[model samples]
Target: MSFPKYPEYKDSGVEWLGEVPAHWGVKQLKYLVTCLDGQRIPLNGVERYSKQGSVPYWGANKIMDYVDEAIFDEELVLLGEDGAPFFDVGKPVAFHSSGPVWPNNHIHVLRPGDSAWVKSIVYGLNATNYIDFVEGSTRDKLTQSRMMSIPLAWPPHDERNHIDSFLDHETARIDALVEEQQRLIELLKEKRQAVISHAVTKGLDPDVPMKDSGVEWLGEVPAHWNVVKFKYLIAEFEQGWSPQCDGDQAETLDEWGVLKVGCVNYGVFDPTENKRLPDNLEPRPELSIRKDDLLISRANTRDLVGSAAHVPMDYPKLMASDKIFVVRLHQRICRSRYAVVYLFGKGVRHQIELQATGASSSMLNIGQGAIRELWIPLPPDSEQDRIVHELEKREADFAALEQETVRHMRILNERRSALISAAVTGKIDVRGWQADQQSRQSEILMAAETRATYG
Candidate 1:
């Protein structure tokens, strides 16, 4: 759907606002809204924890927590002062909040003269390019004075209301579609995990005879399979060295680098998740990663503490960190891919989480002894190869569907941003627009019919 352009247009002096509707006026943001930055109060994590309650505590980009006290009770708009996604055009840096709320010092609060203008101002600010106003060497900072001088297209009251209403209805429709796609992606992930868990724990043959595995979590397994301890399958295991390194990744494969715990995060080796080794430090040639090396994280968050990945190829320039454990399986009995799939199953993951230990909730560590004692249900060598091949085929199919859904979401987001920018900048006239009530009612009826039929 396309919107009609204004009948007449005039050039605006501002470079970003090249032209506007003849009747529309252009003005700086400070003239239309009151700055409430002085009223904001900062809160540390400990302080916020102590005051946790119903009121939302806002930071530069989102709600950080809920606090007991309210700093402002009236409706207002908040813009990021720093640490926001300023460069991402599809994402918003300005948001509105109503009722009781506490905003931190990292956001600049704005009180528009008319409550009706709040949504319009937010839409305009999000559409505007902030490159000319934002400053800072490391982080983008929109200072109070710079934000005040930013330009906006000011339309008559009635026209502004029309744009806001149209945007509210249209964006809601797009958001719903985006939400559906997001939910589909999450469902696909859950299904993928389920398939892996079932394939690894219980063999692919559904009718195979089963027996109790004795362990409660590993309820039952194929009668032919054996439940063995992990230690029996390992040919070799060793922890890696950690050396102070540069923050950036190595530019070339020839440059020395040390792997971070995140290298095995997704159950696949990521060579790029490594820091460049300093030139002055001596390299550990013995610890260099090799092809078929199975790596696991010894220290990470609880969910990822025992994450393991099978190295598909060699990364000779990279050495593992102390937080990672390198292992080699007894190839005669177990394949690296088979071991990785088994470790990633829900049953094994439960054991890893239970054994992980740490003083802080954010980080946990698992010892080598704890890992070796974990139980594994083993099938014959030929069965392991067949399971791995079948899993790879299924994974590829799921990945293609996920990629298509993600592509659709990207297109929808681009359309949303373009519509908002065009309407707020007066590139499109919305005064004559009205909501299609009959069409919305038809959609509602169709949705109901779908549920009835599907259910």
Candidate 2:
């Protein structure tokens, strides 16, 4: 529903703050709050954090590693200093903190002179388009100097509380609806994985006799299937080449693009995950990608290492990077689909998780020898083709459903941002806006649900 506007309005001197309630005054942050930028103690020196430690600690936009003791025991607003899309309304710039808390240097900590000002200022800062205050080209950085200069429309104390209380209840309702959509997206993904895992290990014929495939992960498969080492099924398995190229200058040009390891990270082939080669660079012929070639990541984070994707079509100039392996199954192995599904299947993914090695916790690697040695259930040529055909049909169906859910979530986020901006910016007065939690919750979800159903 469209919210009511103030009965009287007057122009505010600031450009972004056009008009506000007649009595409302425009005030700079410097007058209303004390900017404390020196209280920060870096998280690197401490083992415990504010969230996990004796007190609460805040970073740029989240509760990161906490610190030992609570430095500030008052109400404050946190404006992110870096590492966020400040211009994007979907990612909020301002957040509230109360009680004993320690904020890192990555945020501008503000203790408003009046405690009652806390929520109104936070809502105002969140509603503000940070494109006007934020700096830096590669990453956004909001400094204390710029933050103090920004102005917010200040209403009366009673009106401030009303606005604050109104938003607290309303935003929570919006947040709950968004949370439900997020949970559904995750459930859909899990179901997709389960469907493929079941189809590959157990043939479509559920009544068919089952036998232990001998592998620990693959408990039982059709009696006729053979368990074999990964090496025997492939004609060639080679790691991709690493060519010297400037990351800053690299583009996705047609003539000289090299596949980055990201090509396999998405669970499907993404050719856009390639970098343009240097002018002088010439890649070897074997490094070029063909339609049936299967790309597998050899080095990445714990979860993505050994991620595999079969090339759906030929990409002539694209060469796999050193972080991935290019595999060509033997001609006798029809339609590399069976092997592709088996490698990405839940059972084999678990194996990859266990086998991936790394010098550090963050980075992981899988050796070619380890990949070749891994065991897999090998179905006959004809059976492999049949399984591939069935999986392709199921894959298309699930992909459409997933895309719709993703689109719905995007729409909900945009709506949430617009609603907050309108309430705080005097574009709409929500002082009298109220709804039972159930109806508001359903309203938010239904808007997105209807879109999903229609689209």
Candidate 3:
């Protein structure tokens, strides 16, 4: 997996460039490419919507939409002028696009002097450290002058082609592996949701007698189970107060903080998603969060409205916001964990979405009355405990698998970035590199065997 270093090296005079192969030449980026920023035209959302068509409308980082007109029709590289992930080394700052496309003013367009060098230039720009060149307080901006003055190391024409070919082949392989891991993570999420939905709606006993619950969505529950409105199990519920707070989160437990709606957006409590209360405002001790407190987001996007989470522990300094509701369940009739599982089920989620209302799609609110009217199937207290324990075990297993897959993806992405930096900077020589035919054949055979076994 390790590459060979250059046989001879020479200082490039530039610190970031460091050293290059003895035979390589170094020059500023302006001399190697022509800036085509003047050709870019900016389009607003409404204008683009009216002119929707086949051509891509590019923003700083990605395609924002498709428009009816084309601006440039040649091979070129587009670099983010602002709003790009310049500090994230694993992300790309520049990308190559061909054929007809319309780029917005937020991107800087460049046409390489040599058509063959388009891809190589993209890799080189992406690998460079932009910390010293970018500016701006809110968003990093790569000015045209700073971009043009970037130092670059280049090899002979034929060697540049070889480097491009080597990188294209190797990066594609790493990307494929990353994609497989991503797909596995998504599948695990689907499986986890399915397991929760089935367990909460139907008892673990498959042969249990079934009876109509009168409610269409409740369907047929176990003969002994009772289908009742959510209000029956809720002993009490209260909305919190919102005070103007600092933009940053409370750094220490001693500092008072107000929870944001996003604290339970994913159905898990995130204590860190809070804003610090200003010194001028008095803390409300009565609204302080307590252990096992059930919190639900009262206002959020439609999909996240009515999202709920059970506070695992107490945070005396943290209080719920006006957009959140704190609910206390009747412990004798329902277990907190069991109620959470039922609320997260697909059937209950559908009801929440249907009842939510707002002026805009981005912000929706669910009223307390709507939440109380939602139906839930109730089981014996002992049966509720059993279901929660089984679900906890399954969730642990799924979490471990997902964490491992995500870690593997991180490693692959880091390897890819390192390889590109080494090759483009002449730290490694790739002029003699070629795709390994035998290794590729072995991979194909292994993939086929896996499909056969799984199918």
Total backbone collisions for each predicted model: 0, 6, 0
Q: Write the per-residue lDDT of candidate 3 for residues 316-395, one digit (tens) a residue.
A: 99999999999888877987778877788888889999989865445788999877998889989999999988988998
- Which candidate number would show the highest TM-score if scored against the true structure? 1
What TM-score number comes out for model 2?
Answer: 0.82
What is the TM-score of each predicted model, taking all chains together? 0.84, 0.82, 0.80
lDDT of each: 0.85, 0.76, 0.84
Worst ten-residue run, lDDT, model 2? 446-455
**Structural RMSD, model 1:** 6.1
Q: Flag regions of model 3 displaced more than 4 Å.
A: 1-3, 32-76, 80-83, 98-116, 135-145, 215-218, 235-244, 282-287, 298-306, 322-325, 350-370, 440-455
Where in model 1 is the C-alpha error above 4 Å?
Answer: 33-60, 63-73, 100-107, 136-139, 231-244, 285-287, 298-305, 350-373, 436-455
Candidate 1 per-residue lDDT, tens place, 283-352, comes to 9888988877889999998888999999888888899999999988987788888988888887888889
Residue-level error in angstroms, candidate 2, position 176? 1.2
Query: Who wins the lDDT comparison?
Result: 1
**Where does candidate 2 stray beyond 4 Å?**
32-76, 97-116, 136-144, 241-244, 247-254, 280-286, 314-316, 357-363, 433-455
* Higher-ranked by lDDT: 2 or 3: 3
